[model samples]
Structure formats: structure tokens, C-alpha cells
Target: MQVKHGFIGFGNLAKAVYQGLKEEEEIEFAYFARSRKEADIPYYGRMEDLTAFADVIWLMVKPQDLSAVLEQLKTCDRAGKTIVSPAAGRNIAFIERYLGKEQLVVRIMPNLAMAYRKSVTAFATNQPENENATEIFGLLGKLGKAVQLEENGFDLFTAVFGSGPAFILSFIQIFKEKMQEFNLPGPLLDELLLELTQGTTLYFAQNQKKHSIEELIRNITSKGGTTQAGLDYFRTHEIGKHFEGILDAARKRSEEMSKNGD
Candidate 1:
């Protein structure tokens, strides 16, 4: 049977998810948003119509917009439908308050890498054994690595995986800024950084099973070498701890949002 999937809001993240999953033969996609977007999928003018047409409904609106959207959803006949939400800081319990406890609600934290089908996604659901929820989890695996986690773990997961790409890119930006002395074109510098990151990722992938991350770093560092000097400075200044603070701040914000529900 073909599965109909509907998006409540067709923003960037929604677009990324559609791009990731549209090739699947069993799924049919459509959306209802404030404005129609350019896409090959069907666009519904009314939320009620979209809700009625879809078996799986993706609440792809912003976290702040979720409440208003759910209010509209409350009027829809949602029996037997699965609700999948990726809005950061919003938990299953928050959604359950609107949709009721019996609804199969899947909450996920997937990074922007979803567009490339390489997202590290965290999954949690109100109904773990529901066939629809399980299938959605399996579908997440096809997009990238997917792990079933506790709802409480989402805050940390959002900090690390959900917002991790921008954090990683910021680190790369530091390198780019440092290399500006060479006066290379910005695009060329970006390409070089991309190659460097790709090579590093390949090296890690090749040896990760045999070596710990520390071991990998040790293999690159030599006695009195440039890498060692940098390592010494990094340790001395507690750079790792500083980075952890960034993640902590993000997780704290998620917790606050969960509490405030705003």
C-alpha cells in the first residue's frame, strides 16, 4: 500500500526531509503551508484537507509555531495517523497534551545533513511498539544513522547532533580566518577546507575500529612536533572545556524550552 506523507509547514528543514525521502517508491508527499513552495509534490490549500489525505503527518513548523498548528490539528480527524515532529525542544508529552495519549507521536532531532542523506538522527516516540512509529524509525535509518533514545536525552542530542554541523563549520571558519594571510580567494579557501575535512573524515573512518580518537591524535603527533605544540596549548588553555560550554548552553536552552513550552 502506498503511504501518504503530509508536511504541516514546508520550510527548509521540511524541504531537506522531502529531498531525503522523495525517492522512496512507497511514499507520496504533499504539504500545506502559509505560502505555496516550488516543488513536484502536491500542495494542499487547507490544513484539514492535508490532514485527511496523509497517513503520516510531519509537524515541520518552527517550535514557536507548533502550538498554533496543533490547535488546528486538534479539529482534524487524526485516527490511525502517525505524528512526526522534529521541532527542537518540543517533547512528545507536549504534543500528547494536544493530540491525546493514544496518538503515535515520533519526536526526532536530525541535523541539516539530512539534505545529503547523512544526518545523525535521534528518535523517540510515545508509542515505541507502534508499527507506524517503528517504520518511521527504520526510515530514519535509511536517511542516516538513527538511534532510539529516551525523551530526556533529546536536549543533549539536540546540542550535539542537531546543531553540530554549524559548530563544526565554525571551527572550520577559524581555520579559514587563520589562512587569510595567504590571500587566497574565499571560494578556493572553502574548497581546500572541504578537502581537508573530507580527508580527515576518511582517515577517521579507516582507522576508527582499530584506534581510539586519542590514539588517532597520537599517531599524528610526534615528540616536539607542531601538532604536539598545538596540543600543549590546547590543553593548557582548556579549549575542550570551552567547547563543552557551547554544547551545555544549547542543551540548557532546550531544557528551558521544554519547561516553558515556548
Candidate 2:
């Protein structure tokens, strides 16, 4: 059976989701937005019309705009439709407030890596045993590592997974900036950094099951080597603590948004 998936807001996240799932033979895509997007999918100007057509409806708007969209959604005939949301800070309970208790709402926290089918996603639902809800969770597993987690854990998951890609890239940016001393072209620097990250990831993937992360680091660190010297400076300056602070700050903001957005 071909499942019709409709997006309420066709922004970057919506685009990523569509791009990630577009190749599925059993899934079709469409969008309902204020203005038509550049995408070639079917477009509906009315929320009711889109809801009627879609078996799965993605609440793809930003958190601040989510209320307005849900207000409109509440008026639609949502029978048998699975509501999926990736909005940060908003929980399934928040969506159920407008849609009602019996509605199957799946709350997800995923990054733009969805476009590459490599997002580490979190999934929680109002209806756990519902077959349709389980199907949604299965689809998430196809996209990446999808874990069924409690709602309370979402804030930390958002900080670590939803916001993780950018943080990792920012760390890479530090390397790129330091490599300015090499006088190489900017694109070449990025290419070299990409190789470094990919090689590091491959190394981890190869030995991660049997070895601890600290052991992996120790394997690369020789006694008084360059990596150890850098590691010493990193520890002495408390860089790890500072990086952890970034995650904590993001989690705090997510918690704040969860409460105040109501």
C-alpha cells in the first residue's frame, strides 16, 4: 500500500525528511504551506485538504509556529492519520492537547542528517502498541538508529542528537581554522578534514564493540607524542568541560521551551 505523507511546513526539516524517504516505493509525499515551495511534490493550500489526503501528517513547522499550525490541525478530520512531529521541546502530550488522547502522535528528535539516512533519531508515541505507530517507529529505524525513549529524556536527546551534527562540525571547524597556517586552499582544507573525520569514524566503528573509547584514544597516543601533548593541553584547559557546558545549555533551553510554549 502506498502511504501518503503530508508535511505542514516545507522548510529545511521537511525537505530533509522528504529527501530521506523519497526513494521508498511505498511512500508518496506532498506539502501544505503558506506558499508553494520549490519542490515538485503535490501542494495543498489548505490544511484540511492535506490531512484528508495524507495517511501520515508531519508537523514540520518551527516550535514557535507549532501552536498556530496545531490550532488549524485541530479542525481537520484526523481519523486514522499518524501525526509525526520533530519540533524541539514539544512533546506528544503537547500535541495531544489539541488533537486529543486517542490520536497517535509520534514525537521525534532528528538532525538534518536525515537527508543522508544517517540521523540518530529518538521516537516516543502517545499510543505505543498501535500498529500504525509501530510502523512509524520502524520507518525511523530505516532512517537511522531510532530508540524508543521516555518523554523526560527528550531534552538531553535533543541536545546530543538533534544538535550533535552542528557541534561535531564546529569541532571540525576548529581544525579547519588551525590549518590556515598550511596556506592550502580552503576547499582542500575541508576535504582533508572530511577524510580525517571519516577515517576516525571508520576506526571507531571497526573496534568499538570490543574496546572502550578511552582505550581507542590510548591506542593513538604514544608516550609524549603530538596527540598526547594536545590531549594534555585539552585536559589542562578543561576543554571537555566547556564542550559539555554547551550540551547542558542546549538541554536547559529545550526544557524552557517545553514549558513556556504551552
Candidate 3:
């Protein structure tokens, strides 16, 4: 049987997911949003119509918009449907309050890498054993590395994986800024940075099983070398602790959102 997938909001994350999954033969995609978007899939003018047509409903709206969307969703006849939400800060219990305890609600934290099918996704659900929910969990695996986690673990997951890309790119930006001293064109600098990152990733992929990350760094560093000088400065200034503070701030915001529900 074909699985009908409906999205409540067709924003960037929703578009990334659709792009990642649209090639699957068994999934039929459609969406409803305030404004119609350019896409090959069907667009429903009404939320009720979307709910009725789909077997799985994706609540793809922002965290702030989730409550209003749920208020409308509660009015729809959602029996036998699965609710999948990727909105950060919102938990399964928050969803259950409106949809009731029996609804199969899947909460996920997937980065924007879903567009490239390389997302590291975190999954949690109210009904772990339900056949449809299990299938949804399996589907997440197709998109990327999906790990089932406790709801309480979601904040940290959001900090590391959900918001990780931006943090990583920020580090790359620092490199780019440093390279400006060479007077290279901005676009050329960006291309060089991309290649550097790709090469580093390839190296890690090749040797990760045999070497710990610390071991990999040690292999690159030599006695009284440039890498060692950088490492010494990094450690001496507690830069790693400062980076952890960034993640902690993001996690704290997620916790606050859970409490505020908006």
C-alpha cells in the first residue's frame, strides 16, 4: 500500500525532507501551508483536507507556530494517523496534551542536511511499538543515521546535531577570515575551504575505525610543529570550553521552549 505523507507547513526543513524522500516509490507527498510553494507534489488548500488524505502528518512548522497548528490539528479526524514533528523544543508529551495519549507522535531533531540525505537524525516517539511509528523510524534511517533516544536527551541532541552545521560552518568562517590575509578572491577562498573540509572528512572516514579522533590529531602533530603550537594555544585558552558554552546555550534555549511551549 502507498503511504500518504502530508506536511502541515512547507518551509525549508519540510522541503529538505521532501527532496530527500520523494524518490521513494511507496511515499506519496503533499502539503498545506499559508502560501502555495513551487513543487511537483499536491498542495491542499485546507488543513482538514490534508489530514483526511494523509496516513502520516508532518508538523513542519516552526516551534513558535506549533501550538496554533496543533489547535487546528486536534479538530481533524486523526484516528490511525501518525504525527511526526521535527520542531525543536517541542516534545511528545506536549503534543500528546492536544492529540491525546493514543496518538502515535514521533518527535525528531534532523539537521538541514536532510536535503543531501546526510542528516544525523534523533528520534523519539510516544508509541515505540506501533507498526506505523516503527516504520517511520525506519524511514528516518533511509535519510541518515537515525538513533532512538529518550525525550530528555533531545535538548542535547538539538544542540549537537540539529544546530551543529551552523557551528561547524562558523569554524570554517574563521579559517576563511584568516585566509583573507593572502588576498585571494572570496569565492576562491570558499572553494579552498570546501576542499580542505572534504579532505579532512575523507581522512577521518578512512581511519575512524582504527584511530580515535585524538589519535588522528596526534598523527598530524609533530614535536615542535605548527599543529602543536595551535593545539597548545587552543588548550591554554580553553577554547574547547567556550565552544561547549555555545552548545549549552542552545540546549538551555531548547529547555526554555519546552517550558514556554512557544
Candidate 4:
């Protein structure tokens, strides 16, 4: 039998999930949103209609918009439907507060890389053994690295997995900005940066099994070389600790959202 997946909000994350799974066999898609989006799938204006149509419902609204969406969801006949949420900082317990403990709530932390099936996702569910929840977990395996984790781990997971891509890109931007002395066009500079990142990633992929990350760095750093000079400054300025603060800030915000229900 085909599984019907309904999105409660057709935002970027919802679209990424759709793009990731649309070509899969025996899966149907639909969505309910306050405003109609550009997607080609069937649109349900009413939450009741969407709730009735889907076997699995993805709650795709923002964390701040989650409460209002849940208020509408509570009025719908949601029996036999699995609820999946990717909203950062929100936990299964916060969802259960509206739909109750019996409803299977799957919480996931995934980045926009979901569209490319390369996302590193963190998964947790209110019901671990339930076949439906397990099925959802298996479905996540198709998207990327899906690790089952406790709810308490979600804040760090969100900071690292969900927000990590942007942080990496921000660092890349620093390199791009510094390379303006080359007088290269912006697009060419971006392309060069892409090659650099891809090449570095490929090198890591090829040698990661044999070498630790520190060993990998040491391999690139010759004695008193340019790379060594940069590394010296990086350590002296505690740049790594400053970068860690970015992750810490994201995690703290997630915890605050959980406590404040936002």
C-alpha cells in the first residue's frame, strides 16, 4: 500500500523533504498551509482535510508558529497518523502536550541538505518500538545519516546538524572575501572556493579511516610553514573556541525555545 505524506506547512524544509522523497515508489504527497505555495502537489486548505488524507504528517512550520499550528491540529481527527516535526528546539513532549502521549511523534534535526539526500539527521520518537515510528526512522535512513537519539540530546544535535551548514558556509565566505586581492570576478571566486571545499572533503573521505582529524592537519602542516604560521595564530587567538561559541549560542536558543514553548 502507498504511504500518504502530508505537510502541515509548505515551507523550504517541507519542499526539501518533498524533493528528497517525491521519486520514491508507493508514496503520495499533499500539503495544508495558510497560503498556497508553488509546489505541484495537491493542496488542502483545511487542516481536517489534510489530517484525513495523510498516513504521516510532517509538521513543517517554524518554532514560533508551531503552537498555533498545533492548536488547529488538535481539533482534527488525527487517529492512526504519525506526526513528524523538524522544527528546531521543539521536543516530542511539547508536541505530546497537544496530541497526547498515544500519538506517535517523531522529532528530527536535519539541514537543508535533505534535498540532496546528504543531511546528517538526528531522530527521536515518543514510541520507539511502534512499527509506524520505526518505519519513519527507516525512511529517514534514505535521506542521510539518521541516528536515533534521546530528546535531551536534540539541542546539541540541532545546533550541530541543523545549523552546521550555514556556519561552514560563513567560514567559506571569509576566504572568499579575503581573496578579493586577486581581482577575480565574484562568480569565479565562488567556484574556486567550491573546488577547495570539495577537494578538502574528498581528501578527508579518502583518509578518514586511517587518520584522526589532528593527524590530517599535521600532515598538511610542514615545520615552520605557511600553514603552521596560520595554525599558530589560530591557536593563539583561540579562534576554535570562538567558533564553538557559535554552536553554544544556537544550542542555548533551542533550549530557550523548548522552555518558552516558542
lDDT of each: 0.95, 0.94, 0.95, 0.93
Candidate 2 residue runs with Cα over 4 Å from true position: none
Reference-based lDDT, residue 134, model 2: 95
Instruction: Provide the lDDT at 242 for model 3.
Output: 100
Kindly list the per-residue Cα lDDT of model 3 for residues 1-262, writing each as its tens digit. Answer: 8999999999899999999998999999999998899988999999999999999999999999999999999999999999999999999988999999999999999999998889999999988889998898899998999999999999999999999999999999999998889999999999999999999999999999999999999999998999999999999999999999999999999999988886
Q: Model 3 lDDT vs. the true structure?
A: 0.95
Question: Cα lDDT for residue 99, model 3?
Answer: 95
Give the TM-score of each candidate. 0.98, 0.98, 0.98, 0.98
RMSD of 1: 0.8
* Per-residue alpha-carbon lDDT of candidate 1 for residues 96-152, written as tens digits (9 for 90 to 100): 999999999999999878888999999999888889999999999988999999998
In TM-score terms, candidate 2 sits at 0.98
TM-score of 4: 0.98
Q: lDDT at 48 for candidate 1?
A: 96
Residue lDDT tens for model 4, 77-122? 9988999999887888889999999999999999888898989999
Which is the better candidate, 1 or 2, if ranked by lDDT?
Answer: 1
* Pairs of colliding residues, candidate 2: none
Better of 3 and 4 by lDDT: 3
